[model samples]
Target chain A: MPRPLTIEPNEKTILYTINLKTLFPVRRTLTEIFTRAPRRYVHAVDGISFMIEDGDIFGLAGESGCGKTTTGKTILRLVNPTSGVIGYRPRKQLLDAWRDMGYEPPIIDKFGSIDIAKIPGKYLKPLRREMQMIFQDPYGAFNPRYTVYQILEEPLIIHGIGETREERIDLVAKALEAVKLTPPEEFMHRHPHMLSGGQRQRVGIARALILRPRFIVADEPVSMLDVSIRAEILELMVEVKQRYNLTYLFITHDLAVSRYITNKIAIMYLGRIVEMGDTRRVLDNPLHPYTKALIEAVPDPDPKNRFRIREIPIKGEVPSAIDLPPGCRFHPRCIAFDQHPEIRKYCRTIEPPLIEVEKNHYVSCWLYGTPDEVMKLIKK
Target chain B: MSEVLMRVEGLKTYFYTARGIVKAVDNVSFTLNRGEVLGLAGESGCGKSTTAYSIIRLVPPPGRIVGGRIVFEGQDILKMSSEEYRRKIRWKKISMIFQGAMNALNPVLSIGDQMAEVFMIHKGMSKKEALEESAKLLSMVGIDPKRLRSYPHELSGGMKQRVMIAMALALNPPLVIADEPTTALDVVVQAQVMNVLKKLQKEYKVSIILITHDLSLIAEIADKVAIMYAGKIVEFGTAEHIYLNPQHPYTRGLLASIPRIRGEIKKLEWIPGIPPDLVAPPRGCRFHPRCKYKFEPCDKEEPPMVEVEPGHYVACWLYAKR
Candidate 1:
């Protein structure tokens, strides 16, 4: 029998990496500094937060440029945060020591969550293995000049996974099997050029899994794959998750993919998580206007259900992250606003906080009431 | 029945790659009625685009059309001389809005100049007259004619798409082949672009072959749909018929895999395995490996496409008795 799954508490989250209010701004530094006062930065990723369970699939979903990818990279210390807490519960206790030795992280957090402006860069490397990322474009991610074997081996040699050549080769084979790239010998000697798109993606997954990392940040890994092959890839991910007992921060624009794989889903807007909750709850009955719009936008394959249509409140382009309006970021395109006028005054003036609406469902929209009000409702 | 504006029978487009002849479009056959939208949907390298290219005879080498007939407006396009094909059919009789065709626009030229070039080439219109007509086409696709002065890069992805539509309609062709017209745009923009296509279809009465990887988009706009896999149409039916009751295993797998906006379901079912390599495609049924109901006959001989209901065609072993 399979072991029962249980979510570990945040207290036990030793490597708890918190990205509090990470903001990244587009730097027009060269043009602005010379002529006039520096321009205000684009608030790409406004303040966003979520706890990463040790072995859970933490889904980050939103439209393109909603700061999901930025949040993933910042956790790995790839991009510097603007101003917020990125507290990590590291397995290795040397992070603080490295920091004290003056290994500060980066700055001008336009879209970054924290004030990386305050941190330096030296302490980000050793912790990279704890947090790895799989990018969206399979063709673009794999090194073309190198063969498939070389691409898989490059990471192992860099991370010092194995000493001898045979041990490294064995690790590659295991990784291939995990991704169902069967009979590793068939794939070992070939270049990425010989493989199909699905195979290349499997090779990518194999490469990421070869490191035996605990947490992986996958950004739209299967979005480019064919529908016929998507299941194969997704099934491989599910199988690997169980086999390795790993934690994942799955990032994607497609909510359907998240629905199929993730336990919990977080919906983001221009730069903030508008709604997040249990996958079934969020996908089945979305709370925020933006979430509703996104859900409604996805076309159902069942043609008979075409008559039953959900209303999309927001339409048109996502507003520029820079020079954002001082209110609820979605007010401009919100359809629910017309029915609920009370949402206007404060919703446009004050930024809504992510408050728990139900036991597990968390919403940032003001309509569900403030944290205190929600708590009162819960108590009542 | 509707008069067939474009009919392609047994179309075969092959690419002579180093490894082998990739049978990109093999024995493909379909008909597009005047003032109708026929969606050609499948995954990447499914030959949806190759079918479109073959219809227009833009088959780029090392790709060549070895056989089949393409009849546009009851005229055998295959028999037309290269010059005749160019002069009469290329843009005037039938037009195309290719995937990422937004990039097809010249960066150096204004939207006005680009649209005008289509008119100048096809109609042999003078430069002055072509510019005037370009503005009308732009307005038809919901873009402001004044913005025609803007460069391709200046316009948003959606606007550039609208410009492509405008260019495709410049000569008022009876047929327009739109391959993945709005794949790159956001959902909102995708909706708007699709709306524009529907609106233009109504206005101009031009038949459209809307080819895309998205089945849902096909559901929303396409009146009829052809589900292609490994260069052949496994199933062809009305959008309502195909989406509601997919007879083919491949079609069912596609519908099951997509995540729906409404309803609470346990989990989205994913189709296992990949499409067989076209260079050496599976012997009997291409989808036999992934099909849940595969029998011995499915492994040995290809199932012929049979009509299960009015206008609904499915090629599968389960439906072989039909």
Candidate 2:
């Protein structure tokens, strides 16, 4: 029998990581092949680090190729990271097997934080129950052939939970009801193709929630749905979070939606987190130039502000991640670099480390100065 | 009001699918004036794109414009022959910038070659003259004229969108139809593209039909707004009238649901249900199922489009008797 898992005091961090990176090989051309060109890699996720607290909705925001999706997938172990330590506080059931093996579980420090990145494949199976993922495309995530019942039951079946078919069906019905797909039996026989985008998304949420996971990485869950229905799903997610005490790592490129749902947000640029803090603080008083540009770019839905062309300070396109610029990756298109000549030299020569500007607020820019000599570059 | 560039009346475009007849754009009517941006706003499958396509006479197969009168510059476009329309009115008079239009450019063709093709086919210009004209249009959209030599893949998403804008303006059309021009673009890039579009719109004094699902984007550029639902325009008026004083419940719900960047962050009151299926839309008011302000007549009677105030129109039973 598995040993009972122990809970630690003051362990707020559900998941924390340091300098995670994911790289993929680039395809070479014929001429390059003939010349025996050196291999190149696309730095998809480059040295990003952040902590997700228990029951917190941590938003990862960025444009395409910014690696927000990759970061989420890495946390769920869907995409293996090249390097870095991922500290995860596993649920009780997950650590039971390790305890049963008569091995002292690698619960480091008083907080019981274990480096999930170092865990072997055999141990990852039990841990999978505690960490689940919700994909962006509801249509593509589920099999067309599988009925809604089959789709929801597959996870429980694989995890060897709920011994009888009747027991699993009860759980499925309850999950369906929780997502407000009422009269659950009505949907059980229906296939994914029969469901609308919003309905399918609810099913996706129900599937994710079935395991009652401690942490979930939701990747652009509403980007594919209609705007009218997007809010419904978002509201349902918020309700579920409170009901289950689930920690969410919500990934999206949209700043508006992120602002509405997340308590904390981390803005990514070219695979690096440029700024992070309490959602309101980062959005209301953004210090990073990139963050400022992102906020200014959001089109205000008021005609009074029509034709009021605000000059976006940043110039040029996002630089290619393959041949990343020296020093700060954003230096090429950064407006602050041009405005403040004093910091330009530092920005162009050395990569600025992520440092706390205030309590919980962090930024990685030379304008904020080094940790030892923190400059009051941002106005209060 | 302001020289009408294009006036579409009683337009009906339907898709003959195996399931049923899909009323993609049913009885839609609107007018575009000179130098004005008319935004056709709606959720997905709300027929905003079909309305744009019907105006351009580009509605694809399985879908046909059953009835409509599209009058452009005092000429009935629906009466023109397909060949004549393609040769004369299309691009030369009214061009289109489609969603992900960047991908529409041939990968093998240079930006110069693509833009030059527009002139070659329409104006019967030589390659040299067309290239020169293309370069001019490129610069007009804020892109380097030298990028004419670059391939589509070489340019970023924003640059590619700009190239599409340049191509649309290559013939200097009086009216341009941009369908979700910045849908997939980043916020910063979207701003850049919108800036270029706004500047060029003012410079050229061209009327534009901007179709998008985002209300915020429409509020930024559109002078007039039409809120669509289930293939019908639920409300129509100037941007100020439609936004500041929305009479339609659907419009009200949409505006309320979007989270604002400024002001106090409040809990978004999301509309209850999904948009009606076009294949079998509701009997009367399509949005009644999700509308909180729905009345007894809403589910039984089709609401007529009524002018509540001068130039402000709404199609709802709540304001029907007013």
Measured against the true structure, the TM-scores of the candidates, in listed sequence, are: 0.88, 0.95
Model 2: runs farther than 4 Å from truth?
A1-10, A27-39, A99-105, A370-380
Residues A1-380 of candidate 2: C-alpha lDDT, one tens digit per residue: 11111123356878887888888789998888999999888898998888888989999998899989888887777788889878888766677767775444577657777877777766676777888889999999999999999999999999888999999999999999999999999999999999999999999999999988889999999998877788889999999999999999999988899999999999999889999989998988899999999999888788966667768878788888899999898999998898889888878878776777776688888787642353332221
Number of the predicted model whose lDDT against the real structure is largest: 2
C-alpha positional error of residue A84 in candidate 2 after TM-score superposition, expressed in Å: 1.4
| Model 1, runs deviating above 4 Å | A1-9, A12-31, A92-120, A304-311, A337-343, A370-380, B123-136, B266-271, B289-292
The residue-by-residue lDDT of candidate 1 on A29-60, one tens digit each, is: 77687898666776766777666666678789
Native A-B interface contacts kept, per candidate: 0.44, 0.70
lDDT, residue B322, candidate 2: 28
Q: After superposition, how far is residue A197 of candidate 1 from its true place, in Å?
A: 1.7
TM-score of candidate 1 chain A against the true chain A: 0.85
